[model samples]
Target: MRRRLSIVLTLLTVMMLGVIVTGLSFGEPGAAPMDDYFIENSQSESGANNVVTAVLFDYRGLDTLGEAAVLFTAALGTTLIFRRRRDD
Candidate 1:
């Protein structure tokens, strides 16, 4: 048990060190380039002042409805999974 614990601890230390080294290597994404295209397109198409409201209420409403349907389906599936099936 002691030997297993030491081996696991050593492996965990090595993994954490690897992650820390990786963090120093890659920089975070630039903001301007990412937002520019989407901002330009969504604003032109939607015709609304507030971007989030336009996206949610008008432009992407279908997508939101699909997402709601998916959530409803998941809930129904979960309920059905826990339900006792009648064999009559």
Candidate 2:
């Protein structure tokens, strides 16, 4: 009985995962909506030669920096957790 239950649960979990993956939103691989003014203004306002660079590195710099910080913090946490504890 226990073995049958385990197999049923495993199959159910696999089917659920397949359903979720199949329902995911994966549209055209690469596309952009760039009105020329939006790009030109973004470049000049953010003070970078490239508009995309300005948008990513200037306007969104804080978010990028935060992502880096979070990654660093997670890595540090994981390392500390797995590291050998000192007894001395």
Candidate 3:
């Protein structure tokens, strides 16, 4: 049983290593058209000098807000859980 388990684990490890090597060899992906659009119009449309800032704050404001809300909720929950309760 132990020998079979060891063999199975070794084979899985080798397979995973081969997959990683293959993925790395593919290199960087080609840029999408949306990337070019953002680069060209972010400044004019969003009125933000920085492309990244424009995308996060103007173009994708709602998505960014949702993410912030989730993070804030998580932080509040964590604080509530760890806070001390006063027993009078």
Candidate 4:
């Protein structure tokens, strides 16, 4: 039973490593249509000079806010967890 588990785990590890190597060989991904759209229209639609700023604040405002909220919550939780409590 132990030998079987070891063999299975080893095979799984090798398969995962093979997948990673194969993925890396493809190099960087090509841009999608959305990238072109954002580059072209971000300034006119969002009125931001910077494309990145327009995308983050205008195009994906809610998503950015949600991410910020999640990060803030995580930080607060970590702070609370590690806070020193002085027992009276």
Candidate 5:
């Protein structure tokens, strides 16, 4: 029963993944107007030479900080998990 359930869940996961991939593959590829606006004005607005840096650090600063915090927490958790177990 356990093995059958595992197999069913695995098949469902693969089917869901295939459907997601197929849906994404059919998306229209084009430059959005917002992207063009950002490219044209990012340097002047943010005073950053690199547009990507300007957008990430200036426009999306809070989101970037949150991502960094999450990464730091993950690293700390991994380090703790892998630390030597001292036999007391």
Candidate 6:
């Protein structure tokens, strides 16, 4: 019963995620004013020659930091999962 309930819950969660993702539409009107602003002024504002780098490291620094933290946590979790256990 528990296994069946878990399976049903998993399916429901996957379906919900699919619906949510499908509902998200990119390139709608006024969907991305930031993109235009970043492309136009990233180099001037951040003082970096590369617009992409300036945007990533300066304009979106906190978002990049969050990504790094998530990657680090995932890596740590994977390492811990695969590490050998020693009985001392």
- TM-score for each candidate, following the candidate numbering: 0.42, 0.50, 0.64, 0.66, 0.67, 0.59
> Higher lDDT: candidate 2 or 6?
6
Q: What's the CA RMSD for each of the models?
A: 8.9, 6.4, 8.6, 7.8, 4.7, 3.9
For residues 1-88, write the lDDT of model 5, one tens digit per residue.
Answer: 9999989999999999999988874434545677887889999999999989999999999999999999999999999998999899
Candidate 3 at 77: error in angstroms? Answer: 0.3
lDDT of each: 0.81, 0.83, 0.92, 0.93, 0.91, 0.91
Best by lDDT: 4
Q: Which residue runs of candidate 5 sit more than 4 Å off their true CA positions?
A: 1-30
- Tell me the tens digit of each residue's lDDT in model 2 across 4-72: 998999999999999999999965633545545557688668778877788778878999899999999
Task: After superposing candidate 6 on the true structure, give the runs of residues whose Cα lies further than 4 Å from its correct spot.
Answer: 1-25, 28-31
Best by TM-score: 5
TM-score winner, 2 or 4:
4
What local lDDT score does residue 47 receive in model 5, on the 0 to 100 scale? 96
Candidate 2 segments whose C-alpha is farther than 4 A from its true place = 1-22, 26-38, 85-88
lDDT of 4 at 85: 100
**lDDT tens string, model 3, 1-88?**
9999989999999999999988884435535788889999999998999999999999899999999999999999999998999999
RMSD of 4: 7.8
> What 10-residue stretch in candidate 3 is worst by lDDT?
23-32
Candidate 4 lDDT, tens digit per residue, 1-88? Answer: 9999989999999999999988884435545778889989999999999999999999999999999999999999999998999999
Task: Provide the global lDDT of candidate 1 against the true structure.
Answer: 0.81
Worst 10 residues of 4 by lDDT: 24-33
